[model samples]
Target: MSGVASTRQQEVQRIVDSLSMAIAQHRLKPGMRLVEAQIVDVLSANRNHVQAALQRLALQHIVTIAPNRGAKVARPEAREAREVFIARRAIEHAILAGITIGKMALHNDEIEAHLQAEEVAAASEDRRHIIRELSQFHLLLANISDNRVLSEMFSNLMVRSSLIVALYQRNDTPDCQCQEHRAVITALRAGEVARAQAIMDEHLRHIEQQLELDDAPPPPITLRDALLVSW
Candidate 1:
């Protein structure tokens, strides 16, 4: 009995992780519909477990659930974008500072593994995979920071940021902001904390500049449409 419960929990976690990664990479965008049947099909999980995962994301505000609309990724106002970036800047600044002060270093094998994954994603033709890699790069840093709370917070923010980018992205470069990752990694490897932080700031600044937020209206969809629609 306990084993069955544990397996269900694990499946729920896997669904959440996969969806979060998809969100961060812009594979899932703001205002994009999340249909339960479709999600269950894609995640290959039961409807109940998928529902559990969606509930978890809602707690982080990464997704929103309307009474009859089911759930969709969160689409923040332009003002919210600015607010999010402000918070991100503060959070990442502290993360980098902690890494510097603690002189925390990533394992060589781990770094190489991440880089290899990035390369594979970059080389792939799938836009979704590319976006996933871009988002994971930032998450990897949070993990390296070794602060559990901050890591979880960053994970949630990363999901939201991906949605924002999808709503406002100005270019189609799958490899965007990748060089900045290399720069930060290099600085960290050299024990140059100041350089690492500088690289991150520049990287984030570039992302902010790329948003094309010009007050486009949300695509027309009512509560009825979302519920009736499969995906």
Candidate 2:
């Protein structure tokens, strides 16, 4: 019984992680419907498993499940968009305040690796991949802070931020700028904690500025396109 239950939990977690990655990557945009049959097909999971995954996501505010409409990626409101950034600024500021030269040194290798990945993704000009890489870079910084509680909090913020970006971002603006990330790293390497924190604050502000919160929402894509794993 324990073994079977554990396997079931793992399967559910697997589905949730995949969907979360797609959402964070901007491959699955806000307001996109998540058809169960399509999700089951794309993930090769059972119907029950897919449904369970969607339920978990809904609890996280990552998806919305309607009585008759089924589930769709969450569409955050304009007010919620501003609130998300405010929350992010507070959380990220705390994370940066705790950083030290020794701590930064510990994660230097991982940081460099993530930066390289970001550069490669940017060079490819694959928007989805670039978005995912950029988001992961921030998450990596949180993890480097070595505070599990803070890291988990930032993880949730990243998800909400992703949804907000999907709903409110302008077509012409880039999701993240690689040069800004590099600048933050350079500041940290020089033991200029204040400068690094300032850079991060500026970076977050730049991302939020790209959003057109007052603009009309985009038309939702077809279920097939939404669930297509390749996209």
Candidate 3:
């Protein structure tokens, strides 16, 4: 019984982490169906545990579950996407401003550690993990602001924002390593607040521009039709 429970817990954690990473890296778009059986197969876990994990993600607004529809990745509206970025810019700019004036506090060692971690994750072959690490960079920015409330708010939004980024991303970058982040960090360390803010702004704008809002999705055909055509 204990072993079963342990495995269940691990499965649930794995599902959460997988989805979270997916959202962070823009590999999973908003509104993508997460069919229960498919999730079970993907996670290599039992259906029951996958269901439980889906429910947990729903609570985080990372996924939405509906009657008869089951679970799908959460899709933020266009307005929501704009709002998320707006909030991010405001908070991050403030953090930069504070740092410029020597009002903000952050540990150099911590920032260095996160940068190293980001490098590793960015270089990782696993796209999902890279996405998670990218999303986490914003969380680290929030922490540097020394406001727990802001940190928590950014954390919640990062999950949703990641989905937005994935849904909108049109161009495939060669790697997840954000040169913009590195630039921002460099400027911040040098007490160049304006430079950091500019880099951050450019980064956000580039991400926004890469989303494919006007591109039409490919037409869907029924399996029967596909089979007929193949014949």
lDDT of the structure predicted as candidate 2: 0.83
Q: What are the per-residue Cα lDDT tens digits for candidate 2 across 66-179? A: 999999888888898899899998898878777778888898888889999999988888767788789888888787777889997888789889888877778633554899
Arranged by lDDT, best first: 2, 1, 3
The C-alpha stretches of model 3 lying farther than 4 A from their native spots are: 1-18, 26-29, 34-61, 97-106, 116-126, 174-178, 214-231
Sort all candidates by TM-score, best to worst. Answer: 2, 1, 3
Q: In order, what lDDT does every prediction score?
A: 0.75, 0.83, 0.69
* Winner by lDDT between candidate 3 and candidate 1: 1
* Prediction 1 TM-score vs. true: 0.79
Whole-model lDDT, candidate 3? 0.69
The window of 10 residues in a row where model 1 has the poorest summed lDDT is 222-231
TM-score of every prediction relative to native: 0.79, 0.88, 0.64
Candidate 2 deviant stretches above 4 angstroms = 173-176, 215-231
C-alpha root-mean-square deviation, candidate 1: 4.8
lDDT score at residue 44, model 1, on the 0-100 scale: 67
Per-residue CA lDDT of model 3 for 103-163, tens digit only, reads 3234677767777877887677565566666667777777776777666666667777777
